[model samples]
Target: MASPAPTSAHTGRHLPHPVLVISVVVAYLVALHPGTLPRDAMTTTVVTTGVTALGAVIGMLLARWVSRRHGQPDGQTRRVVLGIGVLVAAGGAGLAVWWQNLIRAAVGAVPVGPDWWAGATLAPVAVVAATVVVPRVTAVIAAAAVALTAGLLTPASAGADEGQPLPRTVSESGTLLRGELSAPEFERPATRLVKTWRGADGLSARAVIVAVPTGSGWVDPAAVTGFVDRFGADVRILALPYADVPSWQAFISDDAAATESSIALVREVAEVLQGRPAGDRPLLVLYGQSLGAVGADAARTWLEDRHPGLLAETVLTAPPAETVAAESDSPRVVVANRTDPVIRWSLSSLWRPATTPDGTVLGGPRVPQVPWLPVISFLQTSVDLLAALDGPTGVGHRYGVEQAHWVTGLPR
Candidate 1:
């Protein structure tokens, strides 16, 4: 007798595999071609593809492991299991969307636009493919493709330098003092920017601002300016470049080099201050934001030991949770938004108990007043960081407008 034809459910189970493979390829191509889609759209596509594919793979693996331990089920039972998997995946996608919307509403964040919808639609398909597709190897391949495409398409750093000549002298209007620092440890010349605000008399204070760049290495000048303005018209602002590469991965890889360069720059500034007359010297302050905060924190110990009273105050905004608190004579203020994912979902905060001294932490204006649950906070915080990228000042993780509030009580 001839073999029986496959059941409709079996045929249906196999259909999503080809569809998923095609979708992955198309998404990758769209991301690769700049004009085909907007830059944000491309990013959204890559992120969605990777996230969905990974989530689906994890779900499928868990389901299979459960089945092996419990014994394999009959065809009808398997079909039911697959249906549940699909429903769960769809539910997760829905939950992510709803959570993101909630965050946007709370912060008045810029809408993520239509590309988010496109990704939302594709996410469920990817999840369904993982659970129902036969020849499990195909599902693995699809997942890998999604991940690789996303990684390759993402921009590495902000690209080339501004190429402007460093200012030679301080002016009535703020002037950007630029210089190059070379060291054996660093691969390239470490560039620095000092925006000096000099009044008719002279400098009253000096602020060394370590910049936090976007994934593309673009720093928000407004953030630096706002921080400096809090100290009044006669404060000199020193801006250091941390992210020179194209992507966040490159910035992370170069962390050691960046830290070394930051320490060197801080030493240089300290020496400049030491040479000035005690009465004439400007009150010294150190400031950093996000990734820049890591570099600034790394230099704290050396600054305190070598020049005890050199730094009057230190301000850190949205610093990573892993940052070790260094003891310094100078007052240290850490500014964080409770809604910020980077701070809330940090491994240091999660694994370690609170050991930071009292009064060191200042609540940001935009932090949500929700109960702290690890899983929920992780999801919300991740979306918070994304929303912050294009969100308005003082909302979410952006601290340009709230700089005054955080720095007001600090010594000048």
Candidate 2:
């Protein structure tokens, strides 16, 4: 005797897993930026979404056919299948087109996995269909698709540009020529600085203090000058961009290879500095707070290895441990406060003690404290944050100086 179709507990006629279907649809929506993969944007999006949607539809139909073969046709099951299937189709189409340009610019091109999208949706759809078709093989295919979704759909940057930009500025004079220079990786056409102190002599000639603000703030030239005057060093400022594509918080938590991206960025900045026209003996000092501190340490390390004689010193104020490298042959300085909110929240967690059974605690934190960390970190963060929130538009990260001044040193 032929058996009737199983019914849902609520509607009494085989309802599909709406929650599972919705989850799959949403994941696909989030993951399906058009040009992220290596192929042409339109083509990749169309092919990826189309194939997955087709697989889902096929799985749905197959499930229905098998169920009918077993003489079980239920209204509730049909309605759920129809509704979720439409969602899959619409979402795929919309996402494939909406972010076509953004995905291309942000993520670039990449290889596609066989089950990237289609595979993800296939499994659950097959499961819902299985209530009717009862095909064991179809269920297996669906599971495989879900596994592929987890593996293939996450966004990763394609390694493309790694070289320095043209018009390198090695000295404050070089900066004066160009008004201001942009840092290597943090290029934004709108947020550039203009250097007005061109041809101004008697600037500090002993050391060039490159102050990188911690948070996402515009570097103030006047404030930089103040620091220079206080410390008796010529200051040059480069307003660093936000730490990463993901938030600074995300970068701190070690999520999604954020540190790796940060390293790449800092390396690019070093390359820019190296390409500048500074003489063989010019001093290059980097000062940073918070994220800028982290970036400074990274830039310092890269400079020491790539161009040994270039980076004279590095001064960090309240940097994350990951941003702090071990004491290198180069002159490196750390200035940290015990009470900075970010230090307590982020660096504290990073530096926590982990002891073995024998009381051997390996790899204790190594953020050495400098005397000026409390003041330096606070001042740097405050100035940078204010500038970031409010744009000086014409000038770079420095407070009063024109953005053109590249490298400034202690007064001659």
Candidate 3:
């Protein structure tokens, strides 16, 4: 005969085990993380479900460990464990919530998180799943860790150019030259080419402009033309339009092998140009925006260090202070919007807020003046990077098409 009283059994069905309860609590609490962009209801639900599912797995593992170590915990022991876990979790969550809410107020956003109804529905499913893995209650509580990733990123962020339109002149007459420079890579178009013309000095010379494709694995040929057209007939453009595909991994990775390759390409170009007679050698110019700008600056630094006087131009748009130190004195031209997060965000931002020194680069009108809180400021800036180029051409991180004036107007 089977017993009818399943409730009286030692299973923690009605009353969740300490590990299960704490996992659910911490899971939902972490789901409140203030992300960069505002997510819709469906996104929140999907994210919450994933987080809950992950938390449940960890909770089950901890419960299993405890069961093996000390057998099934009694109801009193479970209650005590739950009390301590809940208190600690609640205290930390309280501080995080306060900071997140502060960020919401600063960024002109409302509080965001999973809804109560959704939590009520999915949380139990997660708990039940955990309980299935370990039928008896245990004292060990599980900690859930979640990693947020972007499904889509802008070309500026990812160093990807979906469609780069070339100027009509590129197909028309004189069409500059091709194959004057190249990178040692398996890319479709390693570098753009250009023909030489009479410079203001009454001498026929070429200027090779290397476009650092912003942490991008691939290159945009149109970027070469953007500056090439400005040269009229005096420069040869050697911008890279490599065939490598760009991804967020390439964008965030510290090593950024693509960027390093660009530096190597620049070095190769300089070595070849240096081999030419002093007066006949083509002038080298480095131009890039955002991550490209960082690469451009590094290329110039290398050239200046080894082949002094090899570089003729340096245009770095919206470079982060980390790349180009805030204290350095260099002739490099930097065009940066006042609120461009790419230029401002850093690890130090967690403690120090961004301040405008005298002569802020290409300083535009100031945006919202919000109070900065430690961790909240860092989180806010992190998300701001995603939407940095969503604004007008002159605002945020977009510097527009007239970037060649600074270089073109210089004496060559």
Candidate 4:
């Protein structure tokens, strides 16, 4: 009889590793405790489960490829594989933690408890266990488990609130205008506000200012009021409230939706301006903060394409990494606080050196520089960001009284 095929442990499929499965489930449950992750429980569960399953499938594919190339590993080879697997899993865990903190900052959510840490710790442990127990299958299950755990633990955006109805026409004074416009991304009417400041010179040259609201629905009235106070009546301010989706979390998650809506709004605004006689047309200025900044930045290319030379300037304050590209031709200004974690934690700025804009102002109180380790930076900045949120106008994030001063510098 043919020599019994060399009995190989790796030759046949094996049952899932129990240790890996249990660790994964327990870790996820712990991280997703209601206090740890505040959101719609059912939605969280479904999304987390789906992500985990996808990760597992990807891991399995990677393991199979490795097995096909290397065949059954010797003791030493198995040890090497396990070591690499652990390192990769650990890196993944760290990344997940960083991302969680980033999202919390974006959505203005409170970060509570060390449940995420506990979940992160178990991720690598599960991966190593899975690799050792089922060498051929490797750590795919572990990866999947970790993904699910982390995802479930993250906070969800706040649901939209029933807002006051949009107004039909300009305010009685004619300096203020509030109304609604139709945009594809929004199921409800998009809120629009316009405040015109025709200076003592008698609106000879009108300055049209378009401001995007922050994550908190309408643009801060104080900020807008301040702008009008400084600019006088020559300026016309157009504002949009991004309240359809309501939360910053939703804004960040569906950036495309925000971008599309903004572009449409800008297009409509441009059409209205185009209808005016050339001599009467107002000089345009675009402004946004945080998520609003993101929307404004995303619309830059389209804005320039459709209405070249129309914009006097674009101001983005505390902008995220995604909006870091240089707008060399236009007067694009970036106002950032040196100590703000949101500005500092962005990996995009690191990867691609953000193009220094025409004007870059460092606002807020300085935060002492700390050692630049990934884990340390994430933890420190997360706390700092949360504290900044507590201030009356978001201390670090807000431009304070300096907004009008900066607006004065923009071209005519």
Of 1 and 3, the candidate ranking higher by lDDT: 3
- What lDDT would each prediction earn against the true structure? 0.49, 0.40, 0.54, 0.50
Give the per-residue lDDT digits (tens) of candidate 3, residues 83-197: 7766765664565445545544444556646563344345445544654555344113332222223334232354455554222121212323222112344132332222222
Q: Which ten residues in a row have the lowest lDDT in candidate 3?
A: 165-174
> How does residue 184 of candidate 1 score in lDDT?
35
Q: Arrange candidates, best lDDT first.
A: 3, 4, 1, 2
Q: What's each prediction's TM-score? A: 0.64, 0.34, 0.53, 0.52
RMSD of 4: 10.1
- Write one digit per residue (lDDT tens) for candidate 1, span 210-290: 343332234445555665566555455554444445334544576554467567667766776788786777766666666
Predicted model with the maximum lDDT = 3
Using TM-score as the yardstick, the better of models 2 and 3 is 3
TM-score for candidate 1: 0.64
- For candidate 2, the 10 contiguous residues with the lowest summed lDDT are 354-363
Per-residue lDDT tens digits for candidate 4, residues 1-412, read: 7767644454323433322333343333323322111223233334334434334445555555666776544444444444554565456556555555544554455542365465345443444445445745654654665586666444212222244233333232333343353444432233233212323222344666666655444454544665566566566555555444544474555656556656666776676666667667766777776677777776666778887876677777776544556554677777776544455545443333333444677765432332354333443343344334333343454456455446644542
- In candidate 1, the residue pairs with backbone N, CA or C atoms under 3 Å apart (3 or more residues apart, or in different chains) clash, namely 156-246, 156-247, 157-245, 157-246, 157-247, 158-216, 341-381
Looking at candidate 1, the ten consecutive residues that score lowest on lDDT are: 30-39
Candidate 3's displacement at residue 332, Å, is 4.4
